[model samples]
Structures are given as structure tokens and as C-alpha cells.
Target: MNVDELILVSIDDHVVEPADMFKNHLPANLADQAPHVETDASGVDRWIYQGRVTGVSGLNAVVTWPPEEWAKDPAGFAEMRPAVYDIHDRVRDMDRNGILASMCFPTFAGFSAGHLNHFKDPLTVIMIQAYNDWHIDEWAGTYPGRFIPLALLPTWDPQLMVAEIRRVAAKGCRAVTMPELPHLEGLPSYHDITYWGPVFAALSETGLVMCLHIGTGFGALKLAPDAPIDNLIILA
Candidate 1:
């Protein structure tokens, strides 16, 4: 077998959160406050969350187009693979690629779902919890062993993050997506032993791995302002 063709485990794939997630999971009282989609003046659909907006970065939704298209400009929802947004279709694609297991990070929710912290308390907590519930019950459940389940902690508060870690661990989640370099964005850095004490405590007990995805690390791509996308991706 060609070893490259036999790639089986993809630990850093991502999923586009379904638009109706909040509608399906949030109670009527809080559903209206949940992040919803809207096409902007430019006609691109973006997630509007508590005054912060995020659009699909071409990098994350990269399978359906030529590299030039996906790696250069931002791709709207229409440009992504149906599999990138649908669990059933995703499994079919995974099977086709011989991917026995995959772990998906959040798209609109940001790498660790850390971007959601920009919103107020309680609501943000509810939103993150809802995302995890939907991820496990809906997404991963669709393929069971074919998809490894990972959760995102509220990185702003270590104690609360620890609690979430334990909670998700109890629910069978074995990994979490986190910021690669936390201090760069004002969150506690990985080197801060005291800050991550509770987090390590919970994970040490549950044996979960802390997964760090790019884009949540120290700074954005260090490319010249006028550099071509190809050059940046090449450097990356």
C-alpha cells in the first residue's frame, strides 16, 4: 500500500457548525440570543456573535475548490464541501479516504471556541455547552468510531475550563482544541504552570490530550501586506 494514500487518522480537521444548531438546542428563552447567520452587504454569509462577526476562512473550507481559489480569497458557505458541514457525508468521504478516525475543531466558534469568550458570561457558557452537546450527540454520533470526539473549553477562566473538561470527559470526550500560544491573545500561556493547574489536574485524571490548532496561536501569518496568498501558505 502507498503509505501516503493510507493516511488514516486526521487529528486536526474542522467542521462548519450547522446554522440551525442554536435553534435546535437552545431553549426558546435563549435561542434568540444565539449566534445566527446573515448575509452581509458583500453577500457573504457570516456568523454574527455579540457584535463580533466571523466569516469562513478559505483555509478551513478547503476541499471543494482549486488551491488557488480556496487558498486565496475567502470562501462563502456555497463553496465548501457538503461533507465539511454534514456528518453523514463526512463519514462517507472519510471512508473513501481511509480515515479511520478524525477530530474536528470548530469553525465559527474559533479554534478552541475561544472566540466566543468575547461575549458576556452565562450566555457564552450556554453557547459553548450547546456546541459541545451538538458535536457529540449529532456529529460524532453519526460515525462513532470513525470520528474522535473533542471538546473546547472556555479558556478565559481556568477553573471553569477545568470544570468543563471534567464534564466532557465524563461524557467520553478524549481531547480538547486549545489555543497554541494563549498569552499572545491575553489568555494564559501554556508555560504558566500555576494558571493551568486546574486544567492539568482534570486532564491528568481523565487522560485527555490538549489539542492546539493554528490561527489561535501567537499572531496571524507574518506575511508582507502585499504578499500573494501562495507565498504566505508556502511559508506557513
Candidate 2:
């Protein structure tokens, strides 16, 4: 069959979270603590949460750039494609590439958001829910069936994880990203069935799928700490 006849639906696409993601989603009291984008002296935009920088604005959103250009990080959101975060532009880009639909994973705080566990704050659960709301209410909801809603769970607690599963499922999210290796994120490993039993049951009850995205729990591949970022991207 000709390439033009192909109907592709990408199950592993990603979105570079917008600067004002938490603006409408979070409660007023928590608004001050919500993650926001900040530009460093170098001009690279990074997501800052609770006074700490989480992830860069354009970590892997350089798909359309030339190979030689991929080695360099996007100076800021202005340098990245609007499709990387804008729902309408994303659909247009999909059409240009002959993609029917896409299930996008998180990139703002990372795939599973396990980094939030480092904070040990009760507000982490609220943040996860707010992110899911933005993903379901704004991102995928804007385009209806053109985009698939995937959520990030509060993996630090099994009870919270189950609650988030049911909550996002109620918002029309079909899948939630799970840390591929939960133990690495300070959670009980998959081998500990007792700890994860409720989480599994919640997914089964909500009819939501669990997506184990690689590198969410760990790096794509182990390499020296001094390895170049471009090498990690290419090899992974």
C-alpha cells in the first residue's frame, strides 16, 4: 500500500506542557505552588515547581528540526513548534503527517511524575490531579477524538494512585502512565502484589489501561554521567 493510504495512530506521542498549564486547573490556595516555566540566563525555558526546576521546556520536542540541530536544546518555547503544546496546531501537524490520532504522554514533569515523590508533600496528589484535569479538559478535550488522554498518577502512594486512576478515568482519560520500575521511584515493586493489589483493582474497575512508558522509572539506558545529552537521545 502507498504511504498516503496509511492510517497511523501514534500511541506514544508527548506534549511539552505549556507555561500556564496550572493556571485554570489548580485551586487558588495551591496556585502559588503550581509549576511554572522559567527562563534561565541561558534563555532555555524550564519548568519550576515548588522552587525547584523540574524539566526543560523542549527536552524532546525537536522532531521537526534537522538532525544537526537536534543536538542543541530549544532556547525557549518560542523556538519549539507550537504543535509541541498547542492542541489545534498538534492536530494540524498530525494531518500533515497522515496520523489519525495520538495518545500523548507527559513531558512537563516527566512521564510518571515520580519526581514529585521527592517532595514528600501532601500537595503532590493535588498537583497530579490538576495536571490530569488540564490534560483531559483542555489538551485532548479540545480536539475530541483526535487526541487520546493519558494521565500521570501519584505513584508515591498506592491509595492515592488508585484514587487518581478512578478520577482521571472519570474525566475520560483512557490510560495512566505507571513507573516501569516502581521500586526505583521509592514505591513497592511489581513483585509486591499486596501493595499494588488495590491499584490493579482500581484500574480494572475503572476500565482504564496502565501504560508503562520506558524511561519513566529509569533512564532509557545506563551511561556515564558525563555522557553527552545528544548521545543519550540518539542511543535511546
TM-scores vs. true structure, each candidate: 0.91, 0.91
Per-residue lDDT over 124-206 for candidate 2, one digit per residue giving the tens place of the 0 to 100 score: 77888888899999999998998889988877778888878887888788988888887777778888989999999999999
How accurate locally, in lDDT, is each candidate?
0.79, 0.80
- Candidate 1 on 114-172: residue-level lDDT in tens? 67877648789888888888887788877778778888788888888988888888888
Sliding window of 10 residues with minimal summed lDDT for model 2: 214-223
* lDDT, candidate 1, at 232: 53
TM-score of 1: 0.91
RMSD of each: 2.0, 2.2
**Global local distance difference test of model 2:** 0.80
Once superposed on the true structure, which residue ranges of model 2 sit more than 4 Å away at CA? Answer: 71-75, 217-221, 224-236
